[model samples]
Target: MRTTMKLDGADLLDLARGAAFLGTGGGGDPYVGRLMVQQCLDDGLTVEVIDPLDVPDDALVIPTAMMGAPTVLVEKIPSGEEAIASLRALEAHFGRRAFATMPIEIGGINSTIPLVVGARLGLPIVDADGMGRAFPELQMETFGVYGISGSPLCVTNEYGDSALIHGRDNKMMEWLARGAAIRMGGCAYIAEYGMSGADMKRTSIRNTLTLAMRIGRCLREAKDRHENPFDALLRLLPDTPYSYGRIIFKGKIVDMRRETRAGFSVGRARIEGLEGWDGLMEIEIQNENLIARLDGQVRAIVPDLICIMDSETAEPITTEQLRFGQRVTVLSVAVPAIMRSPEALDVFGPKGFGLTEPFTPIESIV
Candidate 1:
């Protein structure tokens, strides 16, 4: 059965927190998503979350997501109408009405994007997502494992211009779509991976929205109880183990050296670890962190979730926000088994990020 609820400002905050926990350190800013969703909610849009079984077997289900660098996405905000335009274009391309719209990932800016589009289209939003955790590429989805392609993608810019692209494969789809996003000034709304509800249920992580809500609730509850929020998260997701690490350092942000070449946020953060640690730790970023080195020793790297969160509240910090001397706790979570397969490595391993050496499972390192 389908369900509907209206989210106020407080509800949106809870949703953002929950989505961030599910993001697993790769989705873009949840703050921007929060603002967009809040705007829709203020306009009195009712968010309808529908179960996967509620959709018919033959129903057309299209998953939508933001394409391009997260830093650029925040700067070049959606033209408000582009989200709806992307959906409308897909509807036009398929020559049929879409039964539902949904998120490709269940967190960050994506968690609320589908809702905005759904509110505008008067359509129901699916309660699931292709990837239970956030991934870096369009093709790195469970849908891909089930042989779904992201081609026939429709990208719409803020100026009402739309382009329908056909890639020989999902890689081509990402390439062509990324190029177009650069031309569109670094961000464009895209609707891709059209499939049936049956196919979606088989490929997607079921009840991911519910999972996000649960994660958010746990974080809030942990804070109230003065318990470890990270521990609470681990308890919530027993399938994924959380890496044990300390509040290695904390300091004010002094400088930010960044570049947006190759469509990735490539930068080095220089933070002077405070208290017992009295030196600099060099942090790296490429969409997400690939390495963290302290005083010339490699501390953490890929396949591990090495993320920087606020020292007090434990909120995640994206690559773009890694500034010098920032008061932050560098935390690492053991990678989930889902991302450890050779095939999965071939798609998103250290080599995929241009690292020649093979990835060492995070558990082996810390």
Candidate 2:
């Protein structure tokens, strides 16, 4: 049976909160995306999400996302004109009207940006996304890993200018798009990796949008009930394929070094143990938290998740917003089984980020 969920302004808040958590301290803040989708509601546009399984096998499905610094994505909100323009450019080039739009990742603004595009174009947003969470590079996606090409990519900026790129390979597409994003003032909206509904079911991560909303709702409800939000998370994630999650380290951020390089917020953060949690914890960031080390031993690495959240409220903190002296709890979650496959790991595992260590699940280490 095919089911659909109609989204409203309030749903976006919950979705944003969940997306932030999944982002693992990157994906840009969801504030801008929330407002953008809210405006779509305010305009009386219908925003609907359909199950990936429900999409007809022959239906044309397009994925949309932002490219460039996660910091830039959060700060610079643009009108819907560019997003719509990008998708239109894709339609023109491919000569196929899209049956739906989906997020390439379920983190920060990218998750909700697709809703704005879908609402404007009268296309339902698919409940699935490529990366269950956020990753730095364009090619670090299940779609790309499984052999879907991101060519015929359309990128648009706030200036109403757009570029259409057809790369020989997805990695090359990523390189070209990264350069384009840099030239488009550090960020731009993209509609790429156009595929059939069947391709989506086979290659994309499933149901992350709804999962994000459920996570957001869990936090909000826990707070309203005066419950431990972290406890709420542990209870909620297991029901889904994420399988296991826990607070790995709790402390205050004592040191952070971040810089904008190659269109990414690249840095490392050191958190001094506090609240009786012994040893120091550190996280390597490139748009997203890639790895965490506790007292020199690898605790969690990429292909898993290393999320930093406010200890008291469980509110996720993005990398660019990290500051010294902020009390935090680092939550590590095991990624889906599909993402841990050898093929998937080769593209986004520890080595993909230049770390020589092998990929290890948080479930085993923490």
Best by TM-score: 2
* Per-residue lDDT over 1-366 for candidate 2, one digit per residue giving the tens place of the 0 to 100 score: 577899976689899999998888777768888998999898999999999999999999988888889777656777767778888899888898999999998899889889999999899999998988899988899999998898989999999888999889888898998889899988888999999999999998899999999999999999999999899889998899899998899999999998889888899999999999999998999999998999989988997889999887789988888999999999899989889999999998888889988987787884
Put down candidate 1 lDDT per residue, 220-299, tens digits, no spaces.
88889999876676666654333333344564445567777756556677777765666677766666566667777666
What overall lDDT goes with each candidate model?
Answer: 0.72, 0.89
Backbone N/Cα/C clashes per model? 3, 0
Best by lDDT: 2
The TM-score, computed over Cα atoms with residue i paired to residue i, of candidate 1 is: 0.86
Error of 1 at 134 (Å): 3.5
Residue 249: error of model 1 in Å?
A: 7.3
Off by over 4 Å in 2: none
User: Candidate 1 deviates by what RMSD?
Assistant: 3.2
Worst 10 residues of 2 by lDDT: 71-80
lDDT of 1 at 200: 86
